[model samples]
Target: MANPNQEIKFTKLFIKNEFVDAVSKKTFPVSNPANEKLVANVAEGDKADVDLAVVAARNAFCRGSVWRNTDPTARGTLLNKLAALVERDSDIIANLIVLENGKTFANAKVEISRFAQILKFYAGFVDKYYGKTIPVDGPIFTYTRKEAIGVVGAILPWNFPVIMLAYKLAPAIAAGCTIIVKAAEQTPLSALYIAALSKEVGFPDGVINVINGFGPTVGHAIVSHLDIRKVAFTGSTDVGRLIMKTAADSNIKKVSLELGGKSPLVIFEDVDIDEAAMVAHNAIFMNHGQVCFAASRHYVHEKIYDEFVKRSAALASMRKVGDPFDADTDQGPQIDEESMKKILHFVDLGKEQGAKLETGGKRIGTEGYFMEPTVFSNVTDDMSIATHEIFGPVQCIIKFKTVDEVIESANRTNYGLMAGVMTKNIDTALTFANAVEAGTVWVNCYSAGAVAAPFGGYKESGIGRELGEEGLSLYLETKTVAIKLPYKN
Candidate 1:
């Protein structure tokens, strides 16, 4: 095993904007997926720590001037300052993400850049916030006010910790809401690093708190905390459901979940076959297919099904996998051994269920949590790989004849997070985009969008949205005030 003490660095938790020892005094190993070794120690917090953090956030929300009737321009300026700070430290954050999350350095940098842009976008929204005017009868006057929601609890995922954190945090803070963010245990380094800078950027001590610990303990504690007025979570459908149940039973805090996805990529016969094939390749391969909206399920037209599979398998095998720090690295290890094992289990289940594995189906080496870029052909809609969110570099191709058939196959799963359509025909693009049961549909690209676009899931995938104006609204509550206007003589 890699030296746990040498690789991991953090030894404390960031609570109330200060690095402090956990009440439990327990430490967990931060593993580097690059070589499957112990990197450093991070604080192991539990319910007591959660309570303290929640109390701090609640008090801050109720008492701090930073988030209470503060100047919108000032809020925007602070966010911009933080964005600049992030840009200046982008390399540091990128390196931490690569070390702790096991994505290629290039991808990590891009993710960091995206995160920065998201913060900037939310900051831009602060000054443009507006309410509504209502016409009143007689001398009565009424108007609605959009106010910030208090004490937001953001539960983030490990796959893209920094980027996902931006997805939830940027808009909430921009809208003048205090937050207690729970970082994923698998990849908490970048978040802690950012927590440090958040203080440096002049956010009040308790305005932003980060707790690094296990999901069931620290995470559950944050969710169940009575003082938290809202919960924003990004993870699997199972966990999102659990959060919903917990929130309902507790404070019924407003919740927004961006959960799991078994996304589909539909290719129409009218589209250029080769172009569709290449797009499909990128759709499933980018970020090693760990994205929430990875086009894992490919619904190719029956006329070109065989060619697509052969080409996709060839493309999957051509990917480069090596050190995450290397600029040339095309793919890196999964977050950890457990995650690799889960992906492997899914692949094995696919084989057991008679889905033909076309190419690349095994662990790559003894070092790290690397798995071969896998592509499975002849997949039935009901196959585990086609239906479940594998969250790895695995692609399952299914055949379809018509638009209706493709739509049906795409919507078969409980997850409806996103879908992609590659078609030259205008009718096909419009039909797929309109009919697909997903929160976001990419016409020709997969996982392509600006921070201005609202991202979320449909059906059991999740609730609420993130990014753009919708995300901004999640952190706000609307109220109306009425008064009697002076009568004109």
Candidate 2:
């Protein structure tokens, strides 16, 4: 049913189970980040478009509406159908992801496949996620029911469009909430394609909608809408704060954010240098260092610091940075020119602040937005690259003498999204795992994302979790029902 060969077809706003243009009929150009070629001219939605989407969502969410009255088990069935549709069209979806987001074909495929699994994972929870009953005092029968939080405004980030969409869309609908998605301005096609599949899967009108536009207009309207009962967002920490304030100001809407990170990865002396090198290398370098939980900060034990640095530098030199469509390519360009410039500015700041530029420090070529895989040695926690979220392929390696010192160094930044530790000693791994401020810590296994795992952050990193059973909670509200037993006189 899905044609991977078909050219980019769905480029307009999706609302109420139909593809429609924005109210103003304005369009924005989407370019391939890898080559700067035009991908599509997507419709640009603003406050007026967002208002239309909200109206459709609210109508579908009203009492006795088709979506509102759908049985929980039926809802799960619909989600499974959506998952099947996604898997069947994974090729087309992955192509869109690669073209728009500038991730390698392998990475894009993996995200699409995993996204399908995540939808299935949440599908299994549709009927199982229910509230509890408490034994309160007196003759009162107190039982609680987990109800949907009504229409949800889900805003996505460009870095991980498919995954971020899954993080919000799957669980929100599973919890019976009608959703209005504000797709990332740069990567809106994949989301729009999937929403079309939802229609084929038999989801009622207004249950799923996606709009494309810049954050200042579409994003701002979603978070500040009075009728939208909840807001789920994945983006920068600064933007997350604004979403919170705007949602509170409008109607005190429920909000959940999966924000930015300066995640750290540490390599201990006890492990094999080769294995530690790969673990630390891929953690940051994967996805062109665009991962929110990328191991941007590298802490190596003092004894093996030089070896780790050497191995890491060699790996960086070998990384293939070019077109995302290249079968053998290992990295791709930044999402856009603005992102590329920001990463370059940080690269400059790293050099100016005295961090040793071990390998790369400049853009790859004049075309596109590609940057060489970069590494810095003799880096301190105070360096700009080490402290900030560059969202690019720049890894900072810091030498540490002891566990306590490394733990302190890892926590020095304002972010705590994810951290990695490479060591054979369980005590060392457990110590670092326990003491580190990250929400998720991988011990010798640095994969922070899984369908079964709860993904989120600590402190300024974010406010709530986005996967597992916990993710569904953000879209639900518990209601307690108790009625006095009819008195028998």
Candidate 3:
């Protein structure tokens, strides 16, 4: 494996604006998935560390605290400063992401750049979040004002650590809420680096604290903490459900979850077969198919299904699977051994169930956690491979006859995170886009989204939205103020 241009190392928890060792004195080794080499031994945070971080966040959000008392415009200025810092150190952050998360170096840079953009996007909203005035006939004057929702707990996922951190932190900080971030143990380096940069940007102590640890300890503590008024999580649906239950049982905290997806990509007969195949390939193969919104299920019109599958399989076969740091590598290893095994298991089950394995389905090499970009054709909706989320680089292609039929098949799963429709017919595009039960539907495109666009799920995929104006609302609450004039004039 090619080493990053710069050496990046972080081995401590960031709490109250300072790097500190965990109270438990325990640490876990973070490995580079591309080469299966130890990256660093990071401080392992548990309930005790979470308690301390939560207390600090609670104090920072309390009345008269510097973070709580800062004006919205000033808050925006701080966020912008942090954004600038991030831009200055973009290369290092990107390198850390590649080293820890095993995404391609180029993709890591894109994520870092987008991280800064998201910060700037939320920074713009700091001074723009407004309240409303209700018109009344009586002498009483009433108005509603938006207020920060105190302390927030953000549990990030390993797939896109820095980007997810930006998604949760930018909005919460923009809304004047203090946050305690729990970085996934598998990829905590970039997050801790971000916390270090936050300290340099002069954000008040405890306004942003990052803990590095596993889910059951640090993650559970953050969700159940009474002082954490709001919780934003991005991970599996099973974990999201657990967070919801914990929040309800503990303090009824406001919760937002961006969870798993068995999203579909529908291709109508009108589109160019080659172009549709390429789009479908990237939708599932990007990020080694570890994306929450990856298009796992593909439905093509019966008229063009054969051509689409042929082109898609050819493209998947040509993809360069190797070390993430390799300049020409099109795909990297899965996050770890567990994920690799799980995906291969699904591939095996698909074959046993009579699904045709079209292109690739085996481990690539003896070392690391790499797998061939697998594709299965003639997949039925009820097949486990078609139904479950095989989060690795595997695609399932099924044939459909009509738009209505595809829509029914697409929405068959409980997930509603995202979907894509490819067609030249405007009516067909609109029909599929309108009928699909997903949160975001792309027409003639796949996985296209922006910071200004609201993104989330509709059904078991998730509970609340993230990104855009709706995301800002997740970190805030509303209170009405009333004034009554003495008697009638």
lDDT values, one for every candidate? 0.85, 0.90, 0.91
Q: Write the per-residue lDDT of candidate 3 for residues 366-406, one digit (tens) a residue.
A: 88889999899999999999899889999999999977788
At residue 472, candidate 3 shows an lDDT of 96
How do all the candidates rank in terms of lDDT, highest first? 3, 2, 1
Candidate achieving the largest TM-score:
3
TM-scores of the models, in the order given: 0.96, 0.97, 0.98
Which has the higher TM-score value, candidate number 1 or candidate number 3?
A: 3
Give candidate 3's root-mean-square deviation (CA, Å).
Answer: 1.3
Lowest summed-lDDT stretch of 10 residues in model 1?
1-10
Of the pair 1 and 2, which is ahead by TM-score?
2
TM-score of 2: 0.97
Q: Whole-model lDDT, candidate 1? A: 0.85
Which residue pairs in candidate 1 collide?
A: 7-39, 8-39, 8-40
Write one digit per residue (lDDT tens) for candidate 1, span 9-57.
4457877778998998999988888786776788898899888887887
